[model samples]
Target: MARLAPSFGHLVFILSLLQVSVVCQTPDNVNSLLTNLFANYNNKIRPVNDQSLPIVLDVSMFLFSVNAVDEVNEKLVTTGFLGLTWTDDLLQWDPTLQNEIFIIFLPQKDIWKPDLVLKNGFKKLTEMGGDFYFLSISNFGDVYWYPYEVFETRCSIDITYFPYDKQTCNVTFIVWSYSADEVIITKSSGGIDFYEYEENSVWTIVSTDSDIKKDSYESEITFTITLQRKPRYYVMNMILPVVCLGLLSLLVFIVPADAGEKMSYSVTVFLAFAVFLTIISAELPVNSESTSILSFYLVLQLMIGALVLIISSIQLRLHYRKSSRGMSKFFVAIVRIDQFLRCVKRYRLCCKKDVTTVENFDKNEEEQSTELEAAIEWSDVTNAIDFLCFWFLLLVNVGLTMFLFLYITGS
Candidate 1:
């Protein structure tokens, strides 16, 4: 019995030693595990055992914020990180062999990463991610790479509505070197992750869409962000002021032709319209693909200002004409039309009958009527022109202002 007891103790001691040896075989530290894993790894090659099978890459965007939407440059600048995941067959390892470590982060430079590039970059086509970035790798060979970037992409600006415009911009990424047969990109289930997104002051994200476009040669993933401009700033600063100027321009006719300020006032308003147009042009891209309705409205107002200036000059010339010269039939007809319109507007039946009764008068009254009609002077002609122009232009300015506002806002 004593001999059997000694053998049993030795057997227990032997089992314990074996257990210690097994534990020693496992990696003691993360560095040692990485060294072993990468000793035979070749990052220059794709991490696939079967060269014929394509790498199914899942892609998603984690939008941070919209930095700017430059209308003049037709560019969209944004801050975001791309979430890319794929299986690297050569990177797999047994978790039990690495102190039960299921996941570890490695410098992105040391991995066989896909050569993803910005397909629609505003500057130039460049590679995604930086050397300082790290990639998360699991024991099952799954790799997760989050590459934060300040992406400036080409976005076609449609300023047809200007401040009230809604723009749809796309940020496209693709594997640059690999063909569609070798690298197939897919939009992840959680396509665009806006959980960490920050709001932009000038633009509000209305909607987002993501999809993978595969062609015969390569595959690309596109993230579409629809933005609506916050027009309060433009409405208060630009649009409203222009509208007021348009209404103010109509007042050129109201200024007395004898008032020395008539020409100067009309000229100043015309110049102001010119300055506003120049300011607006500087803000928009130099393209004729689509023009803003606001621009069109401004041009029309400028033309009206010019017409007012020309008519005012003519009125001044007539006001100073020799009083000995007889008035033309055209001027007489215009004066009569003006009186008739005013009488109709005031609902005065007596004033209406007085205009018609001149035609049916007796011989003595007819002669007096002729003398009265002959009393029309050049000053009367100028006043008649002013009255007609004022009402006509006021209606035009109001109608144009209402149409411009309604069209742009309702768009």
Candidate 2:
């Protein structure tokens, strides 16, 4: 009886297989199968949220040169989720021929007002960031393909940045390209479709888009970025300030090492460097992980500042070396008194005094150091300015050199 039962089950299975094959081979049967499959598939997928669909929007390359964005509603979405369209503009009135576009999507689920403070909410979309993917020209999926120098992202505790929250999350995606005149966004598809279990609404995505286009034929590279916010912060906070500080070093050459305030400028430069660092830090996200070119600049500037202080110390020591026992105390004491009016008065008859006494005093000091004032080479604090300035200038050039070097080599 047991063996018979097994044989019966096998016969039933074979019959089912035969029935399916026959149905599949027939036109009517095949239609029925397709209808059932589509019905079942759509049933499973239709109720899903936007996140469930990994595809973004399609980008249509239409114009040769453009820098603008047009917000499209859900109605604007094409019926079929398919390939993006590429359009070419033959009118060479402008230089490039591709439209610049940055398409962003906010999940529908992020539709709640955030207290934003202690206002616990779902982590920001980026916090949930996993893999980043894009379609390519060939195998083309590249973030670097864009022409812009910086990617703009805003971080705020405000709920308004989220589209669903009625507050739009600001996403600034910038591009800079000379070869492309205009670009159209036809399709943005492909990514993990995220679904919100609670709201069952659309997932939230915060995005910002922007563009800067420049045309220069003489330069080998027609496209160049003016803002340093991405790397621009480096210029405002580190590179520019460093360059400024370097230039300030010229004060060393212009201002005599004999100037009483020479040492003071070291402190001034140090504070300036410190202030610049603060600005750089302020511009970056306050987090544990160090990022951006500004960080490098911070380190560089701080090093430069430290270097300035060190050189200042060396100046003090150098001045100390040039001074003999009694003379050192006498000069120091004399400097402390009335701007050294006593010393200048005693020596002024040697040269024709003019309204620009300070300027002439420096000339005389240099001449005297070389000729008459052989005993007094230079003061420590006074000479510190030149040394500090010299080193600072060198560091600035090095920084610029490095910036240009890295920019060129992409190091």
Deviating ranges (above 4 Å) for candidate 2: 1-238, 286-290, 320-396, 399-401, 408-411
- Prediction RMSDs, each to the true structure: 9.7, 22.7
What lDDT does the true structure give each of the candidates? 0.83, 0.35
For candidate 1, what is the TM-score?
0.84
For lDDT, the strongest prediction is 1
Q: Lowest-scoring 10 consecutive residues by lDDT in candidate 2?
A: 111-120
Q: Which lDDT value does model 1 have at 355?
A: 30
| Candidate 1 backbone overlaps, count | 0
Q: For model 1, what is the error of residue 76's alpha carbon versus the real structure, in angstroms, after optimal superposition?
A: 1.6
Q: Clashes per prediction?
A: 0, 66
Candidate 1 lDDT over 200-291, as tens digits, reads 99899988898888987999998999999998988887778787887888788788878888889988998888888788766544557788
